[model samples]
Target: MKITIAYIEEPPFGWTGRDQAAMGADIELADVVLRAIGVSTIHHHLTSFDELLPGIQEGRWDMNVPLFVTPERAQRVAFSVPVWSIGDGFLLHCGNPKVLTSYEAVAARSDARLGIIAGQVQFESAKSAGVLDRQIVLFKDQPDAISALRAGMIDAYASTAVGNRVLAESADNAALEAVAHNNGGDGRVPIGAFSFNKSNHDLIKAVNKRLIEYLGSADHRARMERYGLTHTEIDGAIISQSAKY
Candidate 1:
């Protein structure tokens, strides 16, 4: 069997490597689960965030790299078991001149501006935290948002805390910093999972079963660690799934 999976350039999760191969935590996880399920070949389709759901829904791909699960998104695609749980954070200029540590903090200041990728859950999260549309700027991808930040077009860029940390560490100038979301003391983090077309029940079931058996294993933990994920994120997925049952 062969499968095609869609992925976006979101580091620590998915990205196009120097050799033009899809590489990252989610990509590797998908490969393992698919191969274990008897898939003989896998195709990695590179796409933008806005296209991930629509592409899968249209059968343009068999599945997508793990993306944050939301009820609105679940309505469009079948999601596998949760793979990772992560919280939001800000990628700001080093020294954080605006002192923007949280969505609420960005909203509280009239002059504060926040950057988010178009069609991402972060936009909704920012809106829920009282950030006005006027204070928010949308970009097509991470590089554009990071460029806007470096150019002083936006005060902060919102994404997963782990991803932002990776970006900050890899940046050439060391000019960026990542600040984990405050969560307002609620400690609620979002969980992500591979998504398939609603009609692909057989494939979804197989992948979910394999994922349940694989996640949090010593080998899985070691592989994920290479992408900057620790047991905190990996085990959180298991814990979150347990709570649901």
Candidate 2:
């Protein structure tokens, strides 16, 4: 009858607002879906990105805010149907003097350094694109990475294209900008969904049922739009989920 969800301070997805209440697209989505599934009470626990999976597996929370679904992660937790599909991008100082548009571009320049949150998929993406270990800097969270980018410690900060855009706009500084990755031939975007302890089959099933009926609804789209998500992201998830499930 009650569910506690873990979330990180990732804007446009989840964050603690001015009022100290959890807010963002993913938090709202979780609230709506969980409530509809008959959860009488809901709790939001703020945690670091690295802690989300282990915390859930330890029974510290019942669910997590949407995160990218990876094969390795699927082995540890059960994910709800995809909620959004998004591509990666970079947060850079305004003017982008280094011309860093993609991971490959950064790799090509020995002087270019990229910042990524520790444990994020971006690290692997950067490595696969030939970025050397010395060219990469890892941070514990988004704020730290953004700080490094602003301070000239890192040439670019890699994260979701949508999240970087929102962060750039909210920064209220003319010195920050976001550039979508040039996926080139691949053109594939990663999909994200709520994750739960693998053993909690009943909870996952109920939430997935409600999520299926709610994800692409008019109300859902409108709510998400307030948090900077568009049909491009929302509809993509619906389409991807349809094919997979």
Candidate 3:
């Protein structure tokens, strides 16, 4: 059957907007993998990260692509074996400006403005950390937040580790730098797989099996590196943690 893939339309992932043309690492990886298994005719596009959960919960879409299998989310949806592990951390403007490092550091500063993704787990993390509701500026999506960051509207941004590399490297802002989590950043955030309904167990298992094959291949590592995944252990954690399955 044709898979209607739902993903957040953003760079180094997949998005169809001005400036950015088509698929990124995740988009291409998903398409290639699914088609290899004879699931051709992929209709892929972007959806807000929050909207994916709502849409899938309501059956508005068949899958949420490039997903990370969080225990909380896994309890409600069927997730394929992870296809990628995305590490995330802080992205700050070029230069050692402010010498910013950790979220707590940003929080301690009264002048700091944090750019966060609304309805995302990171937002919850910030909230749990007591990020003042006012100090936290919520954006509709990642790219929107990045734009604000480049404009110097925000002090620093909490972002996926890979996102930091891409924005710093490819994005217009060449000065952006990704400070690894150990330097007071969150070690990494994992991103992979799609969330299918529990009824799609067959699909889920098939995807997992394919993941085993894919991950073992050198090509997969190349793909991950392209997307900014440096932590190999994340791949193991993604599958092992799914024991809750």
Candidate 4:
């Protein structure tokens, strides 16, 4: 049977429009899973990240690709196994002209605008750090926040380190640079793998079985490396899922 995979333009995670060939680590690895299972798929790139789940709910798509499943989201949708993991990152102007790294630095510079997804962990970190509300501008997606930063509407964008690297290195994002604060895995900032549904229990099991086979393989490691997702401070498949929601 042919499965329709609903994906976004999120780089390294589910890149399609980024390259003419629709190539990405997730896509590449997913190809292996589909081929092994004799399952055919037609990739449908959604207009926006917000559309990912809605499409699934609407029955317009059967799969959501490379999505990070937080505990809260798991309630609304059935997630398949997480395709991979990521670390939080800070995207700043070149040279980090502000020399900003941690939340403390951001809070100290009241003049600087901190861009973050409203309900994301980054915003929670800023909140916990005592960063004032005015200093934080909520965004719908990582790319939007990055665009705002480039446009000078905001001073910095916070997201998974993987996103920071993708945005900073994207030919379109020449002015930005990724700042890795060594925060991943630490108690301060924790991230984890993507999530899929128990709703598709069979599919999830099949994916997990395939993933298990790929675990120590060179190809699996190489594909992930290409996505800029090096070793991360990710929480467990189930535990971190609970906290982020």
Residues 1-245, model 2: lDDT tens digits: 98999999989899998988999999999999998989999989999999999998999999999999999999998999999999999999888999999999999999999999999999999999999999999999988888788889999999999999998897454689999986668657899999999999999999999999999999999999998899999999999999999
TM-score of 3: 0.84
TM-score of each: 0.98, 0.98, 0.84, 0.80
Count of backbone collisions in candidate 4: 9
**Better model by TM-score: candidate 2 vs candidate 3:** 2
Local error of candidate 2 at residue 184 (angstroms): 3.3
Q: Between which residue pairs do clashes occur in model 1?
A: none
Ranking by lDDT: 2, 1, 3, 4
- What C-alpha lDDT, on a 0 to 100 scale, does residue 186 get in candidate 2? 68
| Tens digits of per-residue lDDT for model 1, 116-192 | 99999999999998999999999999889988999999999999999998888984639989999876677778999
Candidate lDDT (C-alpha), each: 0.92, 0.93, 0.69, 0.66
Error of 1 at 158 (Å): 0.2
Candidate 3 backbone clash number: 5
TM-score of 4: 0.80
Candidate 3 regions with alpha-carbon error over 4 angstroms: 17-21, 183-191, 231-245
| RMSD in Å for model 1 | 1.0
Give lDDT for model 1.
0.92
In candidate 3, how many Å is residue 231 off?
5.7
